[model samples]
Target: MSAAPRPADVVIIGAGQAGLAAGYHLRRAGADFVILDAQQVPGGAWQHAWPSLRLFSPAQYSSLPGRMMPIPAGGGYPDAAHVVAYLTDYEQRYRLPIIRPATVRTVRRAGARLAVESSAGTWHARIVVSATGTWWRPFVPHYPGMRDFRGEQVHTAGYRGPEPFHGRRVLVVGGGNSAAQILAELSQVAQTTWATLRPPRLLPDEVDGRALFDLATRRHRATLAGQHPVGAGGIADLGDIVAVAPVREARDRGALKAEPMFSRITTTGVAWADGSAAAFDAILWCTGFRPALAHLAPLRLRGPSGLIGTDGTRALAEPRLHLLGYGDWTGPASATLIGAGRTARQLAGEITAQL
Candidate 1:
């Protein structure tokens, strides 16, 4: 027989950085809550990242409230494992009630209580924080003959490091950081080519909080701060903070060519928007991720887009429902841990006020 069901004041649908940050404040405020993470460990999104991954930023901005990420040697990036370890420690230190392997399948509001159904069972809470996060589902672009390929192909999520493609021709099929970072790293070892629909822009990881985020909170709050200083002679101000090594090298080599975006992905290779096809051994799709929330019903959402879209502190039509760490909707610093903490703290106050 299954154990008895536990009730709580709030049921956070995710236990990643966002939900964990939210829980930190919830616990501090003496709020009764439970964090339900789909994964077995606390490193929500990091678990799916490539093995050789490291924080683009210095470790200083990455650490959470109660714990510190151990500095890696030579001041390089911290790999995905380092993040996993740090988040594991954070959960233990806070004594947060995080239920593991409880991949939430559905959520709803019946009468005044919020109900969450997961692998573990059903949970009832007064409030629900849809922190399943913006990056719940990895997006794999549908292309012709994707399944007909006779070789090994995987999402960037499943990639480990350059060892897999050592001395091989590698084709990275996205323009985002995952595609960029991996492409740059793999280029040093293998013949790597990055395929994108648009001319990709590499962004600087160092986002200035005061100049970018806080500047918008109250003063120029409506506008995103530090969005590439004025007169910055670069593409969308991304070139300033980020140095595009591969693209520059490719530029000098006449190998870098961009289409209007990827149109299709055949098993052999990618087909461009102009109906051109390129063959390859493997293609890494870093298009992006979508949230898997189709199961959650009765929760009215205002998404013309396919997300629980919210501006951190703002409520949906449902007052009890809040969203955290959902891209730039929350705050300018939404993607960063510091921003998540600030947003979660505000949410704690909002929840307290409702209580």
Candidate 2:
């Protein structure tokens, strides 16, 4: 057998918004840690977002812990490229120790510590923070005869631009910001159909991320005070829709209407409950993603919901391991750029206390 590797104080997985936020805090507290990112380049999941995708919040509102994202010269929400550039700059500014293309394969108990198996090598970590968000795990619900459908299917994760879809019949599915934004753009190019489980909740045009965060904070406070709170759910619940320009334009153009989900996939098209069928050249699954927790599968800590049991960011079953930015279960609005900072600060404090 080989010699044992020296243990790190903490090992963070994914160099995205969450990992970067955690790094910001840990560095502030003078902690020794390393971040492992599967992507070779900077900007974690933002690198994969579609070209036209813009943040729901402004640059000032969508910043990490230490540094604020610089607003554009003109004025508007920063798009994916701008966010990616900000992330790259943030990493360089802080000089956070991050290993690139080091894909973590598994993590398991190693006596007093945990052994992290990755493409780079085995890392022994006293504490591990899994910040790998849901971009890699796009969820496409199964429908009857889906396997037999001859047309093309692509998840939003794989979607690049809409030029190739010009003149094609496409179905956009989901009720979130992504679905709305994509449906808006796609409608401009392709003959599109928007499908959702239920009609989407559109926030008032004036409502934005700041308003949403404030509302969520109120709900959280109310919940702690032993009161029943209204609108307690996903960041989407705060303002299920952001009235972006393209989406608003689509609405005005009568292209933003959404219908209930189809009953099944047919060889030639999708079938409705009313026994009607509509042919489509392709289906774009805007359905959201599950957490990328396969690396923790060996821990067997996941519940039926495929979520690790957690008290705040700390794993309930494995105290040494903390999960950040997977979803709301890890922290309030933890998945967004601004939200990651709060959770990262709290988790850093917890880890510091333990250390």
Candidate 3:
């Protein structure tokens, strides 16, 4: 038999911003740990973002811990490719111990510690940092006769750009940022139709010079506590954020339409609950995503609204292996790249203390 696998002090899953941030702190503390990533390369979901898409937050807030993104003077929004490159540079510059392409299939509690099962095999660690952000699992709504529509159906994860639907009728579903961003861009080429489950409230992407970000960090908490309500309350209305950008220009071009969500699809195209069906060449589903924690075994976890519960309602619901990038713990910024650094730092502290 080969040598027995070495047990690490910590094992971090998903090498995104939070994972990398934890790695940064762990390395600085000289802790024995491994950062395991499922992707072939780094950058997490940034690698999967639409090629032309750029970060809404200016570079100042998008940097990782200890280092800042080398942003130019004027306000500039770097695209997805730029972000991926930056993460690569961040990994190299910081010498983060990242193991890539090793997808984690399961994480279970074995007595006191946690056992991480990945494609490579099993890893036993004193503590685990589940830095898997809550955006990968797309929320594709089920419909009656949805599969029979015959037209192509894809989610935001599958969307690359609008060039595919040039001069064609395309239905973009959902009312969130992904939907808005794709709608504003696709309207230039395709006859676009947007649908929502309900009329979503809209807020400015940035208010008082702040881009709404993750919900579990300090900045997010301060913004929430100071504000009348927390969050953009979900998706922002087109009219709210359209004041200072090209969104207004797109609306005037006759390519945009704001409406309630699509209920179903028909032979013609898609069917709305209000007895409306229109012709469409393709349908883009930007319906957002759900939290995926199915891999956790033995350790009980409770998920409501796609968020893991840390508080004790039923003692059995405790997550012996806790999750960090779940949602608004420390406020809105904790869940996003702009403020994930803070969450990662907190997680590192928790892990250090646990070990």
Candidate 4:
């Protein structure tokens, strides 16, 4: 027989912002836990982000528990590198126990405990926190003739910079911040087309991640207080896109306008319902991602919506499993830096009580 699984009070299945935050709180609670990271290095998905990608919030606003991310020396929203550095430092500063390149294969019930099986080894724990975020699972919608397209196609996850697309005709799809930001930069060097399912909603210049986080916090507090606050929809009530500097500059240049999504893709380009067609050299799909939860498949906790029903972060079907940082369903804005810290604090407390 193989060696028996290691034992711990908790096993956090990610070392990204969410997992790190969970580790911080669990450590303070004095729980025995280990963080399993799929990536070989530190920084999580942030390390994979495009060099120019920036956090919409300033350093002070985007922070984890017990440590504040240092403000960028140039004094602006920190770039991906800055965030990566902060995360690297945060894990070291706290001495969070992390096992690298440990891709979790499955999480299943083992007697009264949950068994986490990963490349690094198996761990049996009383609780498992799934903080594996969505960056790994890029979502691309299907279109007729998509496979027939002759042009190069890339997703937000694959896009690095606009240097390669210079002088080429490029189609940028999706209407989220990624699409807008990427389009803004790519348009400068390439002939660009913006396509969206509907009109893109642009937030005023004053609105940003900080404001959105504050709104989410108030909404969360109101719900906890058992009060139904008016206009409780939170950030969704505002708009979709934040007017970052690059996007605003692009808008001023009349490059931010969006066209209706094409009905189908052709080998040459895309065609609209009206029969009009445009040819492009390449297509960039700024489409978003799905939660990276395949490792939890063995648990059979997902509902018809392909999501686990959760009472906050606690899975309804498996209370021993807590899903963190997937999105608001886990906790309002839990996918974000500040939000992860807040939610992890509560989650750690709950697990600590049981431990």
Q: Write the per-residue lDDT of candidate 1 for residues 143-182, one digit (tens) a residue.
A: 7777887556768767777787888766777766566667
Worst 10 residues of 4 by lDDT: 229-238
lDDT string, candidate 4, 119-168, tens digits: 88899999999999999999999999999999999999999999999999
Using TM-score as the measure, the top candidate is 4
TM-score-based ranking, best first? 4, 2, 3, 1
Backbone collisions counted per model: 6, 0, 18, 0
- Candidate 2 — what's its lDDT? 0.89
Q: lDDT, candidate 1, residue 264? A: 66
Against the true structure, candidate 4 reaches a TM-score of 0.97
lDDT of all predictions, in order shown?
Answer: 0.69, 0.89, 0.68, 0.93
Q: Tell me the spans in candidate 2 whose CA falls farther than 4 Å from its real position.
A: 1-4, 233-239
Write the number of the candidate with greater lDDT, choosing between 3 and 4: 4
Per-residue lDDT tens digits for candidate 2, residues 1-355, read 7556757999999999999999999999999899999999999999999999988788999999889899976778889999999999999999999999999999999899999999888889999999999999999999999998899999999999899899999999889889999998999889999989988877777777777766666676677678886565645564578887777888888998989889999997799999888999999999999899999988889988778899889999999999999766888778989889988999999999988
RMSD of each: 4.3, 1.5, 3.8, 1.3
Q: What TM-score, computed on C-alpha atoms, does each candidate reach?
A: 0.82, 0.96, 0.85, 0.97
**Collision pairs in model 1:** 143-265, 197-260, 197-261, 212-225, 212-226, 216-221
Q: Which segments of candidate 1 are over 4 A away from where they belong?
A: 1-5, 145-148, 203-220, 223-235, 240-267, 271-277, 300-302, 309-311
TM-score for candidate 1: 0.82
Which candidate should be chosen as best, given lDDT against the real structure? 4
